[model samples]
Target chain A: MTWHVVTGGAGFIGANLVRRLVQTGGRVVVVDDLSLGRREHLAGLADTLLLQLDAADAGALAAALRMVPDGPVEVWHLCANSDIQKGVTDPSVDLRATFLTTFAVLEVMRTRNWRRLHFASTSAVYGDHGTTAIHELTPTLPVSNYGAMKLASEAIIRAACETFLDSARVFRFPNVVGLPATHGAILDFTRRLIADPQRLAVLGNGMQQKAYLHVAELVDAMLFIRDHADGPHRIYNIGPEDAGIRISAIAEMVRSRVAPAAAIAYGTEARGWVGDVPRFRYDVSRLKALGWAPRLGSAQAVARAVDEIAQQEFCRYDA
Target chain B: MTWHVVTGGAGFIGANLVRRLVQTGGRVVVVDDLSLGRREHLAGLADTLLLQLDAADAGALAAALRMVPDGPVEVWHLCANSDIQKGVTDPSVDLRATFLTTFAVLEVMRTRNWRRLHFASTSAVYGDHGTTAIHELTPTLPVSNYGAMKLASEAIIRAACETFLDSARVFRFPNVVGLPATHGAILDFTRRLIADPQRLAVLGNGMQQKAYLHVAELVDAMLFIRDHADGPHRIYNIGPEDAGIRISAIAEMVRSRVAPAAAIAYGTEARGWVGDVPRFRYDVSRLKALGWAPRLGSAQAVARAVDEIAQQEFCRYDA
Candidate 1:
């Protein structure tokens, strides 16, 4: 019987992961800062320990760890700076939220002699790998501070694995989307259309393309890797087999579902933002070797996510 | 006129770099905390500004930067946790010293609009690459906290370059050894032998082999890279052409020179320390491609370093 500790447990993908872990009859303890994570997301989960505290705070982290029974603990580290754009104004956000949180978590694990760790890294760590499908062995040269911090966190986790951790799994996630989606392009597009039914203003030229894995598929793949993957340290690029869908294609899908009458407009700049990697591709052959693949492609994932988020938000606003 | 800023300037490699910059008639500003740096190392150089401030302190760093004249500024980021062993006891040492210092420097640079940067990274960032001569594209999987912090610093520097800097050079160094030497295997061995000449206990079997670049060669390669390498960001492996010398061989050299009568004893472990990577080889072809090479091989470098350190310490003791 493994006790699962999921940081950022009340956030989007985190909540989905928490639900899956709970459904599997595993004892789950959720540690969240509530800065961006909402408690409402984890509602109705019984016999679960939910500690509202920042993972970067060592004392709070240690206190949260105390709640778990003395046994096999598997850490699913999901806490990170979700607001990638915020890194430009607050450079320390990524460092503190992502890197520091990981350090604190690894330190606690070291002291407690708990070993198994699952880190949620990002494809952004590869920065702009041009048009080539970045393999796990690709030289990670992150351009954004967010990506830099993620890469930093991954390095630390790898170091900890060498030093103390019995096993470690680092999954480089693509743009993940699906139900209970808190943020991203689909959510943003849907919200904008809700605000102005006739006009849809999108950032950049809307040509940016990248893979998107649904949260359900992401969680499923993670579990599959945990059971099957062999390693003291294993890094896998987790995404769909397809190249990915363009932002313009995603916008068309969102507009069709949310506001069919909306006229799409694009920004002058080709990139959405300063640090935005307009194009990225990653090879997921490693994960596929383990017999894991996303059910939906990038465009399909975006369409489904737009619908899910639209339904949830519209029902709330209507009520 | 080029105005140079070298963080950790009073320390070993930093001091060597400052000397070269001063010789070139550049206005050099050195920021050091004196935590491990000795002011005596920079005694002969005149017209050089030495600020007793930690690079990690944002306020102090900004205050120190104000003293420098408004001109062409090139930052040589060498400030780091000199003690790799210290990371084991205080896990935060490398993070605060190495990673935070780089972050603070980059922030200051970004704010001041400083465009040129030279970051002193380490080959330890490559971790245990087995016996292969690791290229610049070698997958970075740092095993030590020190190595992880260095890798983190490189990632941050690269990110900062992409965001702000016009040009950046990231030099991944091997075990650099030379005069005014503050720390490392040679200094440790010499001090231990000086304290007790009769019995010398070596860490591990000391089959631990690694490359050693002389401080002079390292400084030379850096300047060469700065002049020849063109890039928004360029990463070069700075070391000798030949594969490195083993710890046992280094121990034998030190024993013969410092204490011929000392009985050598070995630790049970194969590695010197917990995070110690026993064997690592890096290809210097990248640096060599630019017509740069180390004058001394690994064994020769170690022997010369042992002599230089031996003479410096013995003279002080005699006085």
Candidate 2:
């Protein structure tokens, strides 16, 4: 039986991945700091194997792994200061949560070799270079501290990968949506409509566009790359089938889906909040060559996320 | 009547700046963990207000600030884990020390605004863009984790400036050399020559060209900028007249000055070390426009550094 360790186990993406692993009869271990990830998310599975502590502490991480009842032959290192937009106001908070956390995981893995590690990197790593379709080879010039730190961690991991690890795959994911626990543009619109059905306040001049990829599709792509590729080093872009969708269309889709009576309001500012990715379109031929395409397009993914966030009482659990 | 605080103030460049600050009749505050910085560097000015602590610790920095006899404060935030080639080997150590430490300073500064702060940035922030003349407006695309973290800190500082503190000045300096106690191309070459005086093992093919600035020139320009500029924001390049230099020439210079009799052995396998700045020079006409330039050219700076290092005993003092 295969054993898997998902670092951010109680969070939206990690929990879903844990459920998937459990359904497939794989032994799974989860380590969550619970700052953002809720303990209730992994309530029933507490006995299944959980570590309730910060992942940024390498010692704590090692101690948590030692407590795991079963061995984790493979690792999905998704624990990070995962919020890209959070760095604008307080970049240090983001660095501690994301960059230091990444470093900690790398350090832990340095001593303990694993079958593979699937990193949940974001396309935000590629900063504001108004490109139509960017590739893995495109030089990353991050406009935000979030992207800069993530890219910095990736560079460190490059050196770490030099060691004899089985494999390491860095998946530069597009805006991933569709989850058991939802909080994103889709969810925001759904909530805004719920609060005031007559008006929706969207940031920016409504020209911001972002690439969307379902979390399941992203996780699947990550697994596919890890299972197939024998790369000591691999950097792949995981994105949706469509190029991307404009912010205006997403707002409309959110309005129509949740509150048909609401009027969409654009925060006709020069741009979205500081550090918001204005344009995101990735060339995923690298992953496509490995025979894996996202099941849902950007629009479809947004719609799905809206439905889930509106229907599920996940927000109460998230906050 | 200037009381200037220099974090990492005991480091190579920091010490150099401290020297100039003292020479110009300025009261000084030096903050250094001495992980790399040496205590001996600040020997003569034991009574000049020095803080021998990690700048990353909020408590420590606060204590240091409070310890300082309050005067009109002007801080030169020159603290960082300053080594690009070494960071390629282990990126996280430096990133945490550099990025997190700066984060602490920014947070502290937010509470107690310095009359003005001058940030000592680096040309490494540009990374390996293969460009000859890099500018303040040049697109930053760093190839190493060291550069990445520095660039991230820059973004963080810039954002803070725009919103939190708009008066901070950023000086992206070229490869600064001259009587550094800790590390540099000159230090590395000196150590290599000492280790194997018969043959020196260079990093790359000795062809990695870069703009070199003397620390004396850098600090002088920084002080000049502090005295003159009164704008919403300031970002000026401080470097030598020669925008670029081949590593081969640097190797030759080191050999001649430190160990002429020692043979030169090059690590001629590649164009650069793991994270060496292969190419990309700086244009410091902005500093020149301010009527401040390095007194010595790249060669002169190298030769002078060699003379100083040769005269001084190795591992004798801190910095």
Candidate 3:
């Protein structure tokens, strides 16, 4: 039996991946600092070792890895600062949490002689390369400090895979939304509407479009790529095949759920904020060619997330 | 007059760039930690302000940038851990010297409103892509930690440029060899042969090929690109148009210069070390199209570097 180790395993995507792995009867070990991750997200999982240690700390990471039962180990490196908005305000958040976390994890894996590593990269690595569909090979000219940090981590992982690891896969994820949602447009809209229930403020012109992948489908694609791909180092863009939904559409869905009469006021610029890639498309034909596809497109995924988050928040409010 | 800030100005490439800027009557400020840089490299330079500070320290970098006279500042970011061999032993050296140095410099640039930045990137970012001719758009999959660090820095600079800076150019250098040589095969061979005239132990098969560019030509091309290129973000591969000379050929050239009868013993693998990218080619037509070309091919550059380093070492030996 193989032991799967996940960093940032209490966060949104990491927690979701842990649940999928547990359901398949695999021994799982999760390392999370809980800076942004919630413990309740990983609750009720049987036989899962949740080591509450900062993944950025070298000593703590090594000790946590040692705690796993001696067996074949595969690392799912999903640890990163989830707050892209904060990266705009303070770039150090991305540097210390995202890039440094990756560096610490890679160092541990190198010392422990781990064979395979799966990195959770982001679509932001492409920046706002106009409105063209971006492939895995698109020149990674990141616009934000968050994107830069992720790209830096990707470069390190690629180098380490060649020098030390047996194999590695880097998946560039687009706006992932689902249960236990930490941050994104859907959650932000839901919170804002629940507060005022009248005028909802929208960033940008609300015409900026992008794809969104559900956390469950993201994990499915990750496992599928890991099992099927034989290349020593593989870079795949993970997203839905259909065109992305506009911000206005996502905002409307959120409005319908929380406050249908809320008037939407738009920001001046096309971008939501500094370093925001307002409109871009993902060419995930590489992953599709590998016999994998997302069940929900961007609109459907965002709609589902809005309802789930609204219900979660409403229940908490009622209690 | 515009103020020119050169990071790692006491090192080989940075010193060369400083020399060029000084010749053209530009006010120059040099920042270097002297970890891998030599103070003597900038000795007797006219009116050049030298600040002995680590480029990786954000506060120190900000202070140094503040010290520059109020004027249009264009930063030439060339600071990096020059020793690739050290990276193989410890990856943190590259992480600090290369990536963190760039990050610190960029942060300071962003805060201080320094709009123009010229980054010293490398061909190592291409990794071991066989013998294919690489272009600016070639997939960056660095095989060594040094390469990874450089690539990571490039990603940060790109992001920073899009976010804050006016214009930026990333020059991907390939084996820049010339006077005041800090480290490379030429200088290493010259010292070894000078110490022991009879035997020379070489890493990898002698047939491992790579392109080389004279540092003078590299600086020339960099200035040329800075002046002529109009792209918002420019990435150019700076190298000789000719094919790379083999290690055995360069070794023979060094032996002929210093120790005529030295016997060369080759290593088993095709690469010099674990992170070595033994063979690759740079398609610098992007640069060539910009009305600039290498004055010396790889063979000529290597031969010239061998003579210059041998003379410098011989004078030291005599003293």
- Report the number of the highest-DockQ candidate: 1
lDDT by residue for model 2 over A1-319, one digit each (tens)? 7778788887878887787777777778888887767766766652257778888888888877775444447777777665556776677666767677777877777656654677777787776668568888775656566766677666656645544345678888788787665357777777778778899988888888888877777777776787777657688888985768888998888777667888877887755877776877888888888888887888888777767766764355466
Report DockQ per prediction, comma-separated: 0.79, 0.17, 0.76
Per-candidate count of clashing residue pairs (backbone under 3 Å): 0, 8, 0
Which DockQ value does candidate 1 get?
0.79
lDDT at position B95, candidate 3 = 93
Please tell me how candidate 1 rates in CAPRI terms. Answer: medium
Candidate 3 CAPRI-style tier = medium
Screening candidate 3 with a backbone cut-off below 3 angstroms (N, C-alpha, C), the clashing residue pairs are: none
lDDT of each: 0.88, 0.73, 0.88
**Best-to-worst TM-score order:** 1, 3, 2
- Tens-place lDDT per residue, model 3, A1-319, is 6789999899999999999888888778999888888899989998688888888888888986887765568899988887877887787888889999999998888888887899999999888877889998888889888898998999888878757888889989998988897788888898889899999999899988888888888989998998899878899999987669999999999999999999999888888888888887999988989999988988888888888989987887799
lDDT of 1 by residue, A210-283 (tens): 88888888999889999899979999999988889899998888889889999999987768986788988879
State fnat for each of the candidate structures.
0.70, 0.10, 0.72
lDDT of 3: 0.88
Give every collision pair in model 1: none
Clash-forming residue pairs, model 2: A81-A98, B37-B319, B38-B318, B38-B319, B39-B318, B198-B263, B200-B265, B206-B248
Pick by TM-score: which candidate is best? 1
Please state the error at residue A50 of candidate 1 in Å.
1.9
Candidates 1 and 2, the one with greater TM-score: 1
